[model samples]
Target: MGELDSTLGAVLIAGLLAAVLHGLTILQTFLYTQTSGSDGPLMRCLVLFLWSVDTLHTALISHTLYFYLVTNFGHIGVLAAPTWSIIVAIYLTSLTGIIVRIFLAYRLFLLCGRYRPRLRVALPAIVMIPTMITFLTGLIFASKAFIVRLFARLDTFSVYLYITFSAAALADTLIAVSLCVLLYRSRTGIEQTDSLLTTLIVMTINTGLLTSIFALLCLITYSIWPLKFIYVGMYFSLNKLYVNSLLGSLNARKILQAKQERSTHDHRRSVRSTRFEVVSEPASYLSPAESITMSGVAQKESFASTSNTLHQNHVPDQT
Candidate 1:
């Protein structure tokens, strides 16, 4: 009973949580397609591809859960045998993570200013090494899981699991750090731009930390309890996090851009308002007749200044 609770029950809970995240994923994907009209076709296709993959991943998990708890209900021996859907789901998880990593890495590349040294340009490309390792190892793990197809012998493949997760963690950490460094360097010394960059840096840290922590947790739980399904549960949720993080970053761009535009507009409006106040301040102390005469004089001065500027601009320069 306790084993069932730890293995099957843990998976059940994880699946439910994953389902919730999947719901959020669907909402985000819909929102992105609708709101991100300015995004290029390639980006649109990428989002669509990820959403399709995630939906398929969810279906696979659902099948696995049904097989274990529904079709094979009360069958303890069935727990020892792994379902094909479960094995394949891990591969899909790895695929999602790698795709997102690649996307973020490219963003980092562009973030590095064109005039910067080659080392900065190459840093994000270098991070792909660990990203590739993570994908390859995950592929190997899934292949081995297919061959073994038994929970009891899963521990034999612990080395591959460790390598896969470690590489993922390392890759995520590198991408986050690289982005932060580049964004920090790209700061324009303007308050608004610098503030926007700081927000991006904080976002990078948070998203990177989230995925890396999940990978580490997956590694740790498996190391301690190889035969249990707790790690598998964590793995299920981890992939969803990757997809959500990518979507969140993409969606945030529109918001940040809007904020910048709004701030600039507000600043200009404030400046105009201040100029008006300055022109009217002296008039506040004048009697009504005096104020009327001052206003007329001010209008004449403004018209004279505008006429002079236009005449100067249109007149030919005498050499």
Candidate 2:
């Protein structure tokens, strides 16, 4: 009983911290999209949907914990009976996970063009199907949790939950690896472009790794100590992690774009500086005709250079 109390307390604390971070990330997403104006209508809609789901998830979990700790304090039996709030929380979490997985899968698809058939996109898409199935099954089982009196009596449900978490972890791993591989292959020999891709690769790993690690932790704790609610702690925070990851990924485009613009600007400035240096050199050593010819050639070169720069600036960056 003492251990269970401590575990429940930990779950509540973790949930609170996760909610705070979720709110902060939501603000970040809003500010980033507004400033960048890069995300299209579809992308903006997706971001809004994710934020709403995350808010609902946080509210549901907060209600569940509050009901147990404050409204029904000293009644441990209430903790054994699954509430509608928690069940809905589970559904939202699974839904968020599926959405995020599909989003990344789409990114992988885009990154790997169809010009040449490859398993990069196909493999992750295949893995996601099972992941979605297990998550749905787990949600269904969770809704039936009221039939069991205690956490220890949920052996059948535990199996589904374990599979759900395992599948999620596997899907994340595959997405991260596939994205890294595609990005690595796409790196051009240009240093600026390569640096931008490297930053993207790192962001991909960080986001995917965090969610995968939490899912694995939830699975491990549930398997080893099914009687405890420690796994619930991890499960409650999963949605926030997914939402933050998605938002973070979307917001990153601004950074990449800014870096690319700066790189291009620097390159242009260097070319202009070199041209000026050549034009400013002494031409007194040559005859008047030669000097006149040199001046004419330099003027034509300057005009061409200015036109090229304007065209380059107007053209969109494919990256």
Candidate 3:
């Protein structure tokens, strides 16, 4: 217990640091909304959950290491006893992280997977089985005595740690590979909403690859100091995912705006191209009823001319 006192300090410091970074990231998100008038409650919620879990994870791992390595490290006078409260914290953090992580993976699958009613569902189900198995393996790996009992070749706790890392790596690899297939196939059908879809795809791939590499590194101690500085880096996704969902929401808005503008332009062009006109009535010809009303006009004009000619001939006869 006394030998690893400084290691406990190191763990606590790292946890505190992670917690502080998470706080700052969330604060930044709030500031961005205040300044831009573009708020995202869902994204904020996801990030908040992620960061909180990571912090809780740090606490649980820290407590567990202290109990196992310090309190029960073959101490002479003091003995380790089961504390109900501590056990609850352990279950809450470890289980919660696994559950949330799986939830995020499922969300990603829905976002990127091909669209066929049957295949749409079956793909996620296939990915889930492997993911759950890997997560269960992680829990088993955490219990040093239990796992050692099952596998004799792995004598030390360190070997089981490697197994845990391997399981995580395997799960991450599955997610990465599956998503890559989704991304490749997306080019065939509907036009993707650019920024949002790209972000979703890229992050899915990045997180998958990065997490896998981290797990792989856990196996190789020759690596740089086991990344113990981050205090359960698994939940760090919360901070990074903060802006991702917001960007997706904004992307949707832009796409809709573009569609509306295009529709308006097309409507105006159609109207301009149309040719509508009023019919003109004929004025040169009269109808049968109008011709009857006009019959007296020609007769009156002929009588005036004949009367003038007769007056001139009568004057000649009188002379």
RMSD of each: 9.8, 5.3, 26.1
Instruction: Please write out the lDDT profile of model 3 over residues 174-261, one tens digit for every residue.
Output: 7677666665554332222232335446655765676667556545531344323232333333223323333333333444445545
For residue 106, give model 3's deviation from the true position in Å.
2.5
Query: What lDDT score belongs to each candidate, Candidate 1 first?
Result: 0.81, 0.74, 0.45
Task: Name the 10 consecutive residues with the lowest summed lDDT in model 1.
Answer: 310-319
Task: List where candidate 3 sits over 4 angstroms from the true fold.
Answer: 1-13, 24-52, 58-93, 112-118, 144-160, 188-196, 222-319
List the candidate 1 regions with Cα displacement exceeding 4 Å. 277-319
Off by over 4 Å in 2: 146-149, 277-319
Error of 2 at 223 (Å): 1.2
Pairs of residues clashing in candidate 1: none
Task: Put the candidates in TM-score order, highest first.
Answer: 1, 2, 3
Tens digit of lDDT per residue, candidate 1, span 115-231?
665864688779999999999999998999899889788778778889998999999889888878877776655555666778878888998889999999988998888888899
Alpha carbon deviation, residue 229, candidate 1 (Å): 0.2
Candidate 1 local accuracy as lDDT?
A: 0.81
Better of 2 and 3 by lDDT: 2
Looking at model 2, residue 54 earns an lDDT score of 86
Q: Model 2: per-residue lDDT, tens digit, 1-319?
A: 6776656776677778777877876786776667546446777777778888888887888888788888988877776666677777888988888889888887776666665356655766685786687578767767767566466567866767878888888888888888888778866555666677788889989999889999899899888877777788888888888888887776776666677778777766766665565556636687656655676676566555544533332212222
